[model samples]
Target: MAKPVQLTWLTGAQAIRLHDAGLRPPRGPFAYALVCDVRDPALAALANLALTDADLADERAPSASARTHFRARRSLLRALAAAALGVSPTSVRIAYDSDGAPRVDGLPAFVSVSSRGPLAALAVASSPLGIDLEPFDASAEPVDAVLHPREQAMLAELVSTARARAFLRIWTAKEAYLKALGRGFKRDPATIAATCEAAQFSIDDGGPAPLPVATFAPTMGLGDLIVACAVTA
Candidate 1:
């Protein structure tokens, strides 16, 4: 069985402290994810100093909030990658591939970034990986549009809050798998099937075998947000 991905929730001060200390997550075939608030003032300041000219040129968000989030995510990504590579944060460059997936220049590491509300997440691994975040809505109804037929059938057995929570897990798993595949939503989400059991998840996209997915929720004192990370195993 594949090992589950580990997630770390950090504050702006905590992340900065770790970076300063040159601390990196455990190295191996496994993946790791980090989450933090993008709206924090300390993070914003760190982003302003860490971002390079190329990183700034990539910021074309139409609104101020979008721009701020973009900068924060990029800065966080650079910091994490730099720590792993044991280099200066500003020296690390991030570029997007043709599929719009972010890549760390000159490194074999794979990365994915996601945000929901005030929080942002980053996933890193030696292999291709993806991460997704979604705000859980207690009043949400299961939406069949993005679910496979099998998934719809499974969700139909649940009611009210149970159904809503199940839908959130399935949704994040499918989305994360798609991102990991570097296709994102270009491929129909309904074609991907996801099964959730407690903190574990499995995704079937008509592949040779079901892919393992790891999920974390109610993290960092935010009970309303759900996160999922997927990698080809």
Candidate 2:
């Protein structure tokens, strides 16, 4: 039987410590989701962790802050994947697909990642999955560029604050779904329909059926971020 999905929340420092201690995820048909703060200073030490030449080539960024964030996120992902596969972090090789989605070499697990500001989210599952994170902006409103007509009409009915939250819920859901499909924005956001009601979230891409999408409940320390995950189900 497939294992129930496990969700892990970690700081960059905690991830580094866990990796050093050789901690691993539960085995057998595992699906894991991890969310971390990539801005943690402790992650800087991870720059010394073993990375493929390709990974090193891609590490070059225009700004120091961007480089730091990239290294932290990549290092955390390698740590998580290594733990999941019960291998050393250095043995885990990461490659990217044409869509720029990260893939663990020789591993069947499907992986997806997203980040906004200091936060990063990762999803690794037996089946295809996608995860997205976005900071909550109370003043942000739905835009015509990305919203479906139905979504716009739905948001129009809500008050300002509610509209902002609802827009993010929809936006993240759509992004996650597209990522799951491995198409990203190649599929127009304006063409996908997404909805979040109460504790439930759903997406309809005009396929034979709606996609399975979920919105993570607001955690104490992450109250200002909107997180969503989509998986084939």
Candidate 3:
């Protein structure tokens, strides 16, 4: 049997340095990598990597902002592929399924990444894995529409978005679950089940049974983004 591969998370600068300059520790065999980001410097680096210089220069700053965010996502993904395959950052190739989940062709491992406004996170593993980081934001739209009636009731008891930043916890957990499946919002948001107790929980999916992923919902960041990670065997 193959030994379990380790999971590592890094910021954009860290990932770039680690991959391009060999500044980080060696990742063991079959490890999967994930990088998450919010739309900021991280996005800039990712965009610069993906867009041609001429095209980028011609792009209107405000109008192109959406593309910039998408490009940044691609850049992080490209870097992950390169790092995972032990190749030059430029040599990493990515292919995606109909769902837009990323995969490195011909590699035995799986890598996943996600980004939000100012933060980003990545996860890699021998087994499939997903990760997410979200800052608590009071302005986030009501999540009640997506929450299970039971889960919504529990969320009210555990924390109140009306009073604080409780939504980050649920959002992060949901994001993590989506990432784990490599399907993101493609799957019904409500189908992936978790409790508001701020811990890992299983999804109702039948295959092998979804495992409890990890959640890092700090008590004080109610108004901040909550982060979560899920893995499957």
Candidate 4:
């Protein structure tokens, strides 16, 4: 009988098994992270595999680079999830909700994935959550577009490179929380105030209270990249 297992290879990327990550259900709680270069030559074989009918839709996305990254990252997503769930990667069905959030068909765990530059990151948990990773690119996105005026003023005081890195850190944090809330772009990013220094954020969505957000930089699998995750309190 074939036994599904977590695939770990230090040469290509950082991988964490459920057991190694100490993330077993009914055992309180734990985190699972896998960070890799989707464009790595070593991952070519996995990325080139055929896509199912459903996945093919996402593969058809415009922009050659994004298309490649999408196919590669999502394919590997199945492989990682299968390793954690002890099933064949191909058989691990992935279904997207109306909001575009992905659900690993057989598991009840919350999952999120993000990719940028040379890295792709993912996480799964027993609770609702969101994860995001982005490289520091000062010109890629404008901080004023998503950050509160007060936060932008604070960012403006930092040196050039440091400011960009800080933007990414705080931006990723905001994204992770929005993802956790399943609001995506439905909620305004500028409405949330985040402090990368504190690795936390807060926002009030007219619910008569503010959302208690638990955000952090996950150091496990990230290599030369900025990463963050958000879970409700």
Candidate 5:
């Protein structure tokens, strides 16, 4: 039987199933990443496999090596995705900043992936890419210190984090945009804010525009983790 690479969001406990579906690794210098809610052991194992068996050369140091299982799974998924898009896996390249924002090179654009647990997400773009996930924590304190005045007002007036679920929804959306742009934690989390209701971004300093909020809604809900991803059109 065949399995879909991604699953639909559902109510009740979020349980994700991960499978390689019997894929063979290809030779390449590749860049592949994924995001999953930390609760997902199956997906973690699968990711481990990708990083393990891949025939990719490390971008930071060509002489350096990756574990077999780790390269295998990540490389496999990247290969599969690239194959679907009619590109070569070996030609795929990944570069990252000190902040851990990953970018694909030698291709038309870039792609990135992040996984926490139950949720595994991928972002592909003709430009830079970013992805972020937050399980939603009301205990995390108000995010105002990092936001601009306008962003602070927006969060105060439009969003609610009293419920853990809603908090994650807003947090993930902002993080996704930051990651898509390769800013990540270097940028103020509060500076780039979103709302559960709006699911859009308000970036300080007039950075990149937010991605279409709808792109993330379809992949939401995996355990306590809520994920948001952004990419170039």
Candidate 6:
């Protein structure tokens, strides 16, 4: 089981617009992340149009499919940030810091962006956070070298299909935490011990941290993708 995700599904236009919606921290137990399908021709067009000259250059620098993915996700990312901050979409500039984590200019909130194929995700919180979206593939490698001893034990208890789900779920959670740490995969996965049981995932990331983490299947109706979000405790 994973924490329930209270997702706000934005239309392609809302995702590309700058409105009165301004940046605010999520209240209560609910953590927020915006998800959109950029594969839609309409959304893709808006995303391309939303791109700044710099964004276009970055998009063009990637391979064909990746270029499109980058543009779509970044487009939505800008719109989401702008809406939250009540600013023009073009006024919201995204710059990568030394760690390569995306930051919205002049905002104090922590932001994370992820896209798999056409589905894109963005999370904004007052504390440092990370969010990841990964499609489940039984054939993909699980556990990898990042497996914590406790997580390995948890996996050993599952069999068949359940085993695969648990493996991917745990991986997503761990990756999310690493992102929250602001270093991404630049750190060893083993650096944070991970275990998933029931709907909650816990980790001993070697800290006396103060934020909680939530992992859940997204409500975007994207078939078999799983999402996990981590925020400061």
Who wins the lDDT comparison?
Answer: 1
What does candidate 4 score in Cα RMSD to the true structure? Answer: 6.8
Candidate order by decreasing TM-score: 1, 2, 6, 4, 3, 5
TM accuracy, model 2:
0.83
Which segments of model 5 are wrong by more than 4 Å?
1-73, 88-91, 97-99, 117-119, 138-140, 154-166, 193-211, 214-221
Model 1 spans > 4 angstroms off: 1-18, 25-27, 41-45
Against the true structure, whose TM-score is highest? Answer: 1
Greater-lDDT candidate between 1 and 3: 1
Query: Candidate 3: where are CA atoms >4 Å away?
Result: 1-5, 20-62, 117-119, 139-142, 158-164, 196-210, 216-223
For each candidate, give its TM-score against the true structure: 0.87, 0.83, 0.67, 0.72, 0.57, 0.81
Off by over 4 Å in 6: 1-31, 41-49, 209-211
After superposition, the stretches of candidate 2 with alpha carbons farther than 4 Å from their true spots are 1-28, 41-48, 217-223
Of the two candidates 2 and 4, the one with more favorable lDDT, higher being better, is: 2
Q: What's the lDDT for residue 60 in model 1?
A: 74
| Candidate 1 local lDDT, 21-139, one digit each (tens) | 76765665545566677666666655565577889898877788888788888887887766655667777789888988888898767788888645887877767788898888888
lDDT of each candidate versus the true structure: 0.76, 0.73, 0.57, 0.63, 0.46, 0.68
Q: Model 2 over residues 141-222: C-alpha lDDT tens digits?
A: 7887999998999999998889898998899989988888888889899998987667877787777767657777446365
Tens digits of per-residue lDDT for model 4, 169-216: 777778877887767878899987775435445444445545544444
lDDT of 3 by residue, 17-133 (tens): 666666434544444344444354534554356544533443333545555665665566665656666665465555666776666566655667655543446655557777777
Model 1: ten consecutive residues of lowest lDDT:
1-10
lDDT of candidate 5 over 48-111, digit per residue (tens): 4333222344423223232333344355445534542355555555555577666554555466
lDDT of each residue in 54-154, candidate 6, tens digit only:
66765643478887788777876776665555556778777777988877777655578777777877876555678888888876545658887777777
Please estimate how well model 5 matches the true structure, expressed as its whole-model Cα lDDT.
0.46
